[model samples]
Target: MTPAAPETIAPGVLRLTAPNPGPMTGPGTNSYVVGTGPCVIVDPGVDDDTHLEALVAAAPGAIEAVLVTHAHPDHTGGARRLAARLGVPVRGCDLALAQPYDPDHRVDAPLADGDVLDLGAVTLETVHTPGHAADHLCFFAREARLLLAGDTVMADVTVVILPPDGSMSDYLASIARLQAMPIDAIAPGHGRRLDEPAATLAHIVAHREQREAQVRDALAAGPTTARAIAARLYPDLDPRLTGMAATQVEAHLIRLAENGEAARDGESWRAGN
Candidate 1:
């Protein structure tokens, strides 16, 4: 299949979609080039030479740094290679948080919330939005009002929040933080850019709340595992997404328990009194 070429989403931002589309990655991972000259590449995508070449080619000027939103393979897999190619530093946060998932994860330049990346015409501030992943981050282009939202929020489907590394409460709080920001557009890790940033963030919060209610109802029935609750809640969920659904359900259960709205009985969960 012919790879899609890079498209400009903002004044100094260009996006190129990687060719690794699947159930988890809608269309494919989005590798963005931010700034006009001496730019930064966000999410280098999978370590495919062709994809790396495409991302480098899409940049309008010298690639200063390779910024990773999270340590997920699809987003950070090619970061090292891309950075090496351009003689730039790989920037991100909390490598240990994602080492279990991506054992080979590494970051030359560690980032924290509020850290700014000044690239001449474009400036991006890192917002530590942990939930989708413990080290997950969203970069805000202050002048353009465009947010480079990783898995923190997607345009098409809800992000899977698995425990140990992910937390439903964290995810919700991250959303709240983003809602409070001055964002006009969102360039997500997957799918297309979101123009109605406020509405999209609001809808995601409402959806999570509704899903939490359903989980509460499911738990009220009796003590059951997260997988069973998932089956009950998503009666027609795609077979391939079964595990992810269960993980999401588990995340909610964990959150409910944290809030004293539910209790865990071994592998099963029951609604709190």
Candidate 2:
């Protein structure tokens, strides 16, 4: 049975919810369909028959391609299955990571910065905004000035910065790139539509900056660890979230150390004066 169709965000764009939901989460992962004819599906979301059917039903007829923003399972789980059902090819970054999604399906196209995808009359421009994940990308509607931001810019919690694949430096640069664009609306991957795009972007930037400052302050208090910084910065947060916070804190610390704003002595950290 097909899952219920997602709410309409624009004239032809629809946002479908994935089946997977983790702890400390609101709503669920979002899969978007842009255009009605020869539609483009973004982030097919987790592997679920219901969700896949819902997505197919939402955009009947031709499904030109399935586009993934990142390789995260929550985002690309259904790419292979959906693409096969629609007889179209999957397109995205990190094809290796996406291989496990479906054995038969291949990444037909590589998504990069400034690539324009025609979805009927509407055109979606691909903006490579890595950080949440190295392969992360966002789609911008030039005519509507709307951004279908993947996990890179969610309305709920800030996207995680997993090392090796994730970089704080790249994430900040991506945010700045988005800020430089003419975005009026943000259709996030996991939350309600954001009308004031500029204000929302500002708030996200300010929040990250404040967290960086807090990390510096924690380092200044004497030799401290990422866990210590997280504790100091989020005293009231749940203990389970401390680990995630520490990861973020560590990302900031690493970035600061690279810039000479902070340094590590042995096993402890200290901020430069």
Candidate 3:
């Protein structure tokens, strides 16, 4: 699919929305080009050839570096290919920590939470927000007061927190961390840009809290499996999304267990001390 022309979203930021749209990825993944003369590309989107060419064409200057918010396929799939094409390095979190563990998902330069990528016009600071994915990172353009929030915060959908790699507690902490920052707008991984950072973050937190309450209540009834709890809570859920719902339920249960509010019994969860 052909990507629309790059739109200038900020002072020196151009947004190129890829063409791999779906229920999870609303209007496809957003790839941002920051700065001029020597630009920095963030989240290269999918591995489609057309999208790769679009990314290259979107940049007004030489592509300095390809920055990945995480190693998720939808975000980092075309990162290496794009970097290789431009002879630039792909920088992101340690690949060893990435989910679905792909050895081919290369990161030439590993970025830490406090690391900064100076792009002359603006500096994009890394903010490690692990919840939706273990290696998720959000880029904060302090000068613009715009956060390049990957899957950590979406414009229209709640991020899925799948356990084993994702944690509800960690997600909340990440949200709080962002809340403490002076952000004016959020360039999320999906959908339109969020202008109300404070209200958006608060709403996300409140929704999670409400869902956790529902999860806790579901558990209090009796020891049950994550799938069972999801079935009880999401009666009108689409069959295709049942698994995702169950995974989210398990993540919530894991957080509850961590807080000593719930206990795990083999494959089931029950109320605890």
Candidate 4:
């Protein structure tokens, strides 16, 4: 498939998608340049040299700051290289988020919640929305009511909430925070730009709740490991997708355990209430 070329989706907002594409990353990671004159690049995508060169060429003006949504490779692989090329510091909620796949690639600054970054023509307000990753961040365009959603929300796919670093509670609360915003459009980390922010957010919220219910029903058959639960929930599951389904089940169970409705004993899980 042809990779996404740099295109201006909104006033001063240009999207450049990387070459990496898969079940998880959709049509590769979307790198965005948000503003004119001195602009801010969000999520520099994978570390392929060609992609980096294309990003630099497509940018409308001097790159003032490089912002990362999270530290995941597909989303941040090119950060350090791009930052060095542009002679600008990488910015994100966690400095670590700016580090590319290479350990030597690192962020120059930390962006705290509520911090406002000026991109010359447009202004981006940092919103710390941890869930997809503990250090995930979303940028809100103050005047335009636009959200640079990153992987916190996707166009067609639901984000995976893995354990340890990923939390269902944080993800849900983060979604709630976005739901409270007066958003005009969401430039997601993958797929197409989303309109009808309120409805889309609602659907995402409901989708998780539905997953929780499915997990609960599957548990009605008794205590089981996440893999067994996945088999029960998705009888026709493709072998390739088993890991994804299992991780999602584990995430839901983690939340259920927190709410005192489930318990984990070794590798098995059972309903507590």
Candidate 5:
């Protein structure tokens, strides 16, 4: 598939794919410019000079607000610099989201659930979807019913849930909530846009559930670490991605423990009581 590019996707939505494509960031981070006259930028990809110029040039006219979907550096690193150049306030679920990864990312406003940013022609309603990242937010466009699903839902691959901070149970619930919404299509953080949001969301939920079952079976053998279970379930997975696979296994283990389906013994997990 083609990487993200600078193009008008909908009536008032613009997509610009940064050049930082890799395993973590599928086709790099997808930066979206929403609205016509005064636009709201969501997840300005990287902090590179080239990407910043493309974003500013591809934008409509004046940048009213700069919005970050989550705290990941690839998504929010350019937000502060772009905001500074445009002289607009940076908005996000929390200012602290950008602090740890990017100290220079200055957040001017915090977006709460149900908060709406009206840009005359188009309006963006914030939906707090925290699973991939605790502070992840998806913006719903009222007119096109397009969901600017950050890393919460990827356009190509399934959303990767990082454990400890990212919860499998919470991610499942968040996706369920999104399925209930009036989403026509998903403009994800990576890859191309996804259609039939309902089907896609359902598949994601079911896919996670299947993986949870596989982890349970892996645990049935004996007490094991998350990495061990990941190896058992995905033995052929790429070496570099084994860590991510382990994290996902750990997330399922945590959810299973919470549901009394699995028991934890320090770093090792066994079948629940």
Candidate 6:
């Protein structure tokens, strides 16, 4: 399902949908525009001509900088093309691929806990919410108490924990960090906007805990593989989804092993004290 063109979410922010659809669910990626004068574009979505045109049409002449949440192809694919068209610097924690970004581009801007981007009318505070990826970030609007959550917190599905790049421990820590923030609304990377922001965070936290418990139980029953643990945990889930769930389970197992709750013996895994 191709999503509609760019739509305004607030007075100064517009959400644009990319044309590329993923393998599972979610029809398109989301790109966001913030502020009017000296505007900032976040997560330019997939590299598609239509999505780029839509973003250009929506922002017009005021585009100042492009900000990416992470280095994933879905999110950062259009950054170079869009930045080139706008003749503006593309800024993100990760370096822009292929072409060298403009000297004005702030790649190492040091996005610590309370760093804020004052984009004329609106101010976006950066929260280093890693785990979806090492360089992931979430922007927050203090006035509206709204969180522009990247893949760190999606509405419909769980983000992949592609290890070395992603970590289950960091993901849980990031969720706890966001839960502590005074947020009222959540504009996720995918699916519909979340109304009950706090409740949503709570649900995600609880769900992860439940999955961890299931993994623990499966290990206790007998020496099990990650695939076996995932099968037991998600018994009624689709066959295709099991592969993704297994990746998640493996991440959990790695975390558990690190914490001394589980151990690996060559190909097999077992519960530990």
lDDT (Cα, tens digit) per residue for candidate 2, span 25-86: 35778889887576988888877888888888888447899998877777778888888887
Candidate 6: regions farther than 4 A off: 1-3, 95-113, 236-238
Best by lDDT: 1
What digit string (tens of lDDT, one per residue) describes model 5 on residues 1-273? 333457877778999988888988886888998988788888887877787877777777678888998888889888888888888898988734422555566568989989998866788899999888778889999899999999999976878888656888889999989988988999999988988889889889889989988998888888999999888888899899999998888989999999999998888999998
lDDT of 1 by residue, 1-273 (tens): 455688989989999998888989999999899987879999988988888898888888888899999988989889988888889999998647733577777889899999998777888899999999999989999889999998898878988898879989999999999999999999999989999999999999999999999999998888889999999888999998999899889999999999998998888889887
Clashes of each: 0, 0, 0, 0, 0, 0
Instruction: List, residue by residue over 158-238, the lDDT tens digit for candidate 3.
Output: 899987788899999999999999999999999899999999999999999999999999888888899999998899998
Per-residue accuracy of model 6 over 85-197 as CA lDDT, tens digit each: 87877676653333222333335344555778877778889888877677778989776777889888787687777666678899999999998889988888876778898
Off by over 4 Å in 1: none
What TM-score number comes out for model 6?
0.89
Whole-model lDDT per candidate: 0.89, 0.80, 0.88, 0.85, 0.85, 0.78
The RMSD of every model to the true structure, in order and in angstroms, is 1.2, 2.8, 1.3, 2.4, 2.4, 4.0
Judge candidate 2 against the unseen true structure and give its global Cα lDDT, from 0 to 1. Answer: 0.80
Q: How does each model score on TM-score?
A: 0.97, 0.91, 0.96, 0.93, 0.94, 0.89
* Candidate order, lDDT descending: 1, 3, 5, 4, 2, 6
Query: Worst lDDT window (10 residues) for model 2?
Result: 97-106
Q: Which ten residues in a row have the lowest lDDT in candidate 6?
A: 95-104
Cα RMSD of predicted structure 3: 1.3
